[model samples]
Target: MRKIIIGVMGPGERAREDHVRNAFELGRLIAQEGWVTLTGGRNAGVMEAASLGAKEAGGLTLGILPTRDRNLISVAVDIPIITDMGSARNNINALTSDLIIACGLGTGTASEVALALKANTPVILLTENEEGKRFFKALKPKLVFIAKEPSEAIQMAKEILSP
Candidate 1:
């Protein structure tokens, strides 16, 4: 069977503590379930945190880098795709993963969420932003799910990925 890939999308530089913390737990849990954790693959913010969490849990991690800068790569990233596709790589992040969990909303994350929904990929939004929640939920009511916590998001992911 193919391994499930869980894309953890969030802010790279503007990620807050909650976003980082939740992304860590999400990555760890995803790894615990033998799923792959996919992220932007930078050494900062949510991407770094989630990758670290998955690596610590003995899970695989795939980094979809927007740039070719090897120095920007995260130490936790085992498989670096080195896209150099810039923001356009967001589409790859959204479409390639089996499911997407938006740990925190940002300009890039918003676009990724939309792309995922457009492709009918199940997305669980874990954000404290009411405006963002309202906006995304409005796009695809059936495909969008609002998660208040990382654990809850994982539970929802289970339901979505299960046969």
Candidate 2:
């Protein structure tokens, strides 16, 4: 059987502690389910946390980097694909995954969610705020799943992705 790839999308450089923690928990849960984890490959923010969590859980991690500069890649990434596509790398990240979990809201993360929707991949937004609630309601109905916590997001992904 082919392994499922769960994409973890969020802020790249700086993020709140809660966001980072949620991403970590989400990644850990994804790994425990025997799924692979994919991220933007940066060494900061939610990307780093998720990748590290997956690595620590003995799960494989794929880092689709936005630059050809290998120095910026995360050490937790078991596989690295350097694209040099800048924000356009979000498209690759979205298309390559079977599902996506958005840990935080940002321009880049929103773009990734849009790209994932365009690619017909399931997306679960892991945030509980007015912005998140409004964004979820604004999107196409039944297209994006919203979860209040990391475990709920993972559960929703599993149910949505299940054949």
Candidate 3:
């Protein structure tokens, strides 16, 4: 059976405290459920936090890097796929994951969510950004869901991915 991959998307450098906390918990919970946690692979913000939690919880983590700089890769990343494609790597992140949980609102995260929606992939927006929620939901009513919390995001992932 293929392991489910849940991509954690959020701001890299300017991550909010809530976003970091939520991403960590989400990664931990995702690990507990025996799922793979995927992130941007950077050593900052949600990518680092989520990978750290997942790695600590004994989960497999895959990081899709937007840069060729190996030093930027998260220490917790078990597998890092270096992509020199820059922000365009968001396409890979959005398309590769079985599900995506947007941990916060950011330009990068928004693009990932949009790419996911465009591909008809399921996304759970785990942010309090009402405007973002409204915009995304307006784009894909069924494919886009909102979760106010990390645990709820996990539950929504299950509901979205289950056969």
lDDT of 2 by residue, 33-91 (tens): 99999999989899999999998889999999999988888888999998898998899
The per-candidate count of clashes, in order, stands at 0, 0, 0
Q: Which 10 consecutive residues of model 1 have the lowest summed lDDT?
A: 146-155
In candidate 1, position 1 carries an lDDT of 83
Give residue 20's lDDT in candidate 3 (0 to 100): 97
Give the per-residue lDDT digits (tens) of candidate 1, residues 1-163. Answer: 8999999999888899999999999999999989999999999899999999999899999999999999999999999999998999999999999999998888999999999998999899998989999988888999999988988998999998889
Worst 10 residues of 3 by lDDT: 151-160
List, residue by residue over 121-159, the lDDT tens digit for candidate 3. Answer: 899998889999999999899999998888888888888
Each prediction's RMSD to truth: 0.7, 1.2, 0.7
Error of 2 at 99 (Å): 0.9
lDDT of each: 0.93, 0.87, 0.93
Candidate 1, residue 30: how far the Cα is off, in Å: 0.3
Tell me the lDDT of model 3 at 19.
95
TM-score for all predictions? Answer: 0.98, 0.95, 0.98
